[model samples]
Target: MNHKVVSLFAGAGGLDLGFQMAGGYDLLWANDNDPDAVSTYKANLGNHAVLGDIREISSEEIPECDVVLGGFPCQGFSLANTGRRADDARNVLYLEMLRVVASKRPKAFVAENVKGLMLMSKGEVLRRIVADFEELGYDVQWKILNAADYGVPQRRERVFIVGTRHDLEVDFEFPTPTHGRKPDSGKLPWVSVGHALGGLPDPDSRHDLTNHTYSKYKLRFNGYMGHRAIDPELPAPTVTGRGDNKGGVVVLHHPSNERRMSVRELALVQSFPLNFEFACNQSAAYRLIGNAVAPSVGRSVAQSLQQALKTAKVAVKGD
Candidate 1:
């Protein structure tokens, strides 16, 4: 039987998809606020996607599940942008997950956020998040994981927290690094911009504003050629809401080509399935993609969780 999971703040179902790939979990419910994200999630995840803001949804309204997945808003806790003062409302949303955990009491959960969360508010914020989860009766294990370490092309780093209900009492372990070993890195292969966007329309030629294009990688020899490469070896760079617009630094098409990465390419780099279509408009697509958790990472954690559950089940049977 597939393990059941309820996902919150589920953007584009990336986390859910990863867990599914790991071979045991079936998403019982998924939540997201953006219409575009919701649409994409629904299309990809089917009936599980709850198209609305998570805060407005009641815990009782959700179905039962073995695990809960969430990647809450990070603006207030993110170090990349300024204005994360003591009073940002977004920072407090972590409490929302706490509230849901108290009510739903899933067997386990995996929460993700920007790596800066580790040092936010000089670490006080992270401390609070841990304490809050513990208070809700969970044993939490967290680590800074880079997409690069996991074989993604991007160099994005994130903080992942895995927690089990106090009753479970099972210590969670992060996945071992898959890349960077001797043979793999004997000559460390860096998946550069060329690998990410090698042949696409010119970023300038493509006027699709809905895509939210971010920064494109510059070609070393031909700065004017707008070509981006796809490095399959390293973890992919962080997929952001602005990947389509070339707003943030991104792997662009050949400089002369002008087209930024299409939404499908972004999803692929983020480890989404090729057939998995983003259900929203271009801008909405960026938002969902940017906020999504890499499925590969999620699948790794899910595999670990599934093993723990099986071990628990076996112990109970023996007893």
Candidate 2:
């Protein structure tokens, strides 16, 4: 069958690339608010993403599609924000998705966000979101996924809420973890940071020196902002979407070097191809990378969705 996807919150095309690479979806349209992200998306994924705020774009303008993809703004629901509330403006952004889904009525939809969303208001926020989607006639399900378990050399945990139109026979099962420290699950050991960054030479070669460049002043406030050096022996912690290459940002320091991890190295850890450029300054590059859905994790979900679609069709035919 065909999988035509219309994506919202399409930042730098991470999730979009994953779905396209997973090989069922033909991306019909995509949207995002950031100019740089839209530029990067066009550069890396071709010209599909529209540059504008989702709130302003009416649902009628969105093309019809089988799946709707969103990586909604997570700050309002993130643990980093202690002042979050049920009425937080950002918390309601998913309603924009609801608007589009209600208007387009896609067969399936998927939304990704920081894991903190599950704990917001002791989970009331999540319950409400699920209820709203259910009211849309979707069979809703969600799970917290750790990227390390899905082949990315990062342990970033995220929540994915997937919905199938109520009438479909297939249920969306979150993909099982394929990597862990213990042996009982028949899974491979988690990919270490070394697995991704071990091949680079000392950060002086032009390629290394240029791409692996760091903020000289960042070391001035060393150890501030909870910044720590990365450990190559294990998967990295969650990669945040903001970094100044200078101090006053969140980034893991290079395991071997004193400087912060460069945009390329960060992209590698996020499972993005080496050739995939961020097309922005160092800080913007760091910010976009930090904010993106890890492509490896996105691919895992896309693959499962594809399977569910196939199974649902077979069931319908048999009946």
Candidate 3:
């Protein structure tokens, strides 16, 4: 059975695309406040994505679905945001996700956030979040997953919290790493930046690639976030929305160390399809791509959920 899904805080539809690629998900509805992200999502994914703040939209407006998916705003829970605080107003956004799950009562729900969430307030924040879901009778589980482990060329790590309705009697298992730093017997080596961006033409030269443009921000090797040079032999570092201390868009140094990776290249590293178009300007495109959950990682998680649900269905039939 194809599971209907309602996506909240759906930035550029990366996670939604992954669920679609997994083949058993139907994106019934999606909501995001960013106009540019909504435009890009509509252009490439579908017209279901709506632009509006989740807080203003009532649960009655959202469609009922088998699953709920969201990667809520993570800046307040991100270590990179030096000003991260337990009291940051944005940190409470997850409660909005919770509010929906409580109202919709989907069979399963998935929430994603920055890795810092696990460490926030000495892990108290995560504990409270889990407890809140459990209060709604869900068997909740959460883990930190690295994007590179699931074929993304970047080593981005994020926390995924999965909850299955208690009555469903299903345990959601996180997907195993298919690629690793040191490949054992069956695993593949981590995809390198060079491998992911192998055939792309230079941004300076004429190219037909969508969003094949780079930021003109001067290279600064001051050992800050976006200024460091990328090693072609290894996975690229996490793509971030902010660059430097001044909060400009992050444009990581190309593997060549001569220039920053073009928007297309960064999107490629995030495992977005080459044909996927960002309907926004260069800076906005960079921010959207940076803030997105890598499509490859999302696919892995979706596939795992599919297996677990199938298994539970079979068990229920037998009973």
Q: What tens-digit string does per-residue lDDT give for candidate 1 at 64-106?
A: 7778888888866766556666468887877778888788777
Whole-model lDDT per candidate? 0.68, 0.82, 0.89
lDDT of 2 at 53: 92
Name the lDDT of candidate 3.
0.89
Best by lDDT: 3
Angstrom error of the Cα, residue 192, model 2: value is 1.0
lDDT of 2 by residue, 141-222 (tens): 9999999988799888899999988877677799988888563458888888877888876555656233355444354334
Best by TM-score: 3
Model 2, residue pairs in steric clash: 240-290, 241-287, 241-290, 241-291
Off by over 4 Å in 2: 208-212, 220-226, 242-248, 313-319
lDDT of 3 by residue, 24-94 (tens): 88999999999999999999888999899999999999988888999999999999988999999999998
Clashing residue pairs in candidate 3 are none
lDDT of 1 at 138: 84
